[model samples]
Target: MDPDRVPRVRDMRVRVLRATTSSRARGPLLCIGTVALIIAVILGAWVRPAPGTTDTPAAKSHALSVAWPSQGQASALVEGLGDSGDLGNKGPQEPVPIASITKVMTAYVILRDHPLRAGQRGPGITIDRTAADESFSGVESSVPVREGQRLSERQVLELMLIPSGNNIARMLARWDAGSQEAFVRKMNRAARDLGMRHTVYTGASGLEETTVSTSSDQLKLARRVMRDATFRSIVAKPSTTVPGVPGTIRNTNTLLGTAGVIGLKTGSSTPAGGALMWAATAPDGNGNDRLILGVVLHQHADTNPRQGSQAALSNSRALIEAVREWLSTITSGTG
Candidate 1:
């Protein structure tokens, strides 16, 4: 049980060799016999170690001293796209409502069913009456699109992701799978395929309180979805002008461009609180890039969506900066 004692075995071996050498004056035969006996005992105790003993160095645990969100679950990973390792976790592992981060899977499934290349428009989707009505109702974040108005598939994704539009998400869901109920099946299936075991997708837009997931589960989905070039391009945008939508719709993820953040998603609601699935890149201190992925959920729950979102954004920014600083300290050994 005491690893400290393991090193003493080598010291004992050195002493035994010295004893054998000094005893050569007695006789070669006796010295050899005595040395063999001592060596056998040492080898039996040290080389053939007991059940729980090990001579190998213990693996060091890399735990970050992050000031995590005051409430809800938070988990982060480093080098997710490469040789990945978990940095740490905070709060419980149980699943809870994820708000609009559900759209990440919605986008993932749509992309898998209909692939898009760089600069490709993919297909045209007509705005439906429900989506149009939701836009004007002021119930949730949305981009205005008239019913029967046609927009490119790429533009729809831009609106859904950047602005965190619930209606746009449903429109895309219905357009792809004929109904939100069926589309949710695809979302859950995609979650299962991606190894998100703690996740459950009950709706395409994540407006349903039943669409619950853990922070760790969302991080897994974050890594997989970020691989798509088109998906990455859409989430990173700060703002975009979509056809059939008024003005320039902006991304709710304000953490973009801070701490080398590139693209990901943000979700919030009265029940889900503020949740964000975020990605960023920084130097690994070895002249190569490292990808950082993280998720924070359930900040300021039961509050208004705007307040929840603000809390999520603020907490996430602090986490990003702290992670970057941790990396810098590791590389420089100055922490």
Candidate 2:
């Protein structure tokens, strides 16, 4: 039946009641009947339901079921270029120690303070004895360099991000903001500006175990960093040759090039477990490319760096492939 016609039917009933009423009571009854009809018309207009419909699902039950790693927290964004929002997340959203993934922020802050462009090496930073000496420490990741040797800002960033160099991170922090302590304040401020309320930065290098963030928070950083061409080019390299470093330095993120993963950073320690902030590109089955940004944190917690890092790499690669496969199925109408 037409919903619009229901209001008219009720109006007709009220009029018929008024005609049958006694004259003395007619006036008062007619007022009430008129008010009732107006209310019915208002309600019918307000609750305008579709002409003809039944309760049913709008689309197939193609809900994606991801096999998230049993350990750690993970979040991802898969969408076309310039699109916002993420593909939702798996595991907890609470902040956790993010290991060297902290360096991504270090690089970000440096680039913000001293911007670098493609093919342009920025200012040169002299290696201080402190940074040089820390390179020999067996406890954290570092690359040896002689005191007083100078490297450009671009080269220093390459060292810090590609090799996950803790000392390089400190050096850049000190160079950019006078000291590591001062630089950490900038990091925390940057986090706040980025809307990462759950994140905290206690050190320039994430070695302190106090430097913490969530996978979702790091994903926010991931999107911002990829916008920088310099950061994008540096992190995407699987290996690079740097002056003063023996042989060649390689990226800590072993997942590079796997499942279309292009570039990002990885972090691991006994306290922070293993963490990765990664970016990739894949076809969205709609003739457009989708940029996929993801973060996995606290994989294999309390384990050594090697074990933790391996776990992060393995899990992230699997997650990337799974997302791509799911997108394809949905596009084919078989999800």
TM-score per prediction, in order, is 0.78, 0.78
259-304: candidate 1 lDDT, tens digit per residue: 8999789998899989999998887555456778889999898998
Show where candidate 1 strays beyond 4 Å.
1-60, 80-84, 329-335
Alpha-carbon RMSD, each predicted model: 9.4, 11.1
Error of model 2, residue 233, in angstroms: 0.3
Error of 2 at 217 (Å): 0.9
Please provide, for model 2 over 43-69, each residue's C-alpha lDDT reduced to its tens digit, 9 standing for 90 to 100: 665555444322111111235565567
lDDT of model 1, residue 30 = 87
lDDT (CA) for every model shown? Answer: 0.82, 0.81
Point out where model 2 deviates above 4 Å: 1-62, 81-85, 329-335
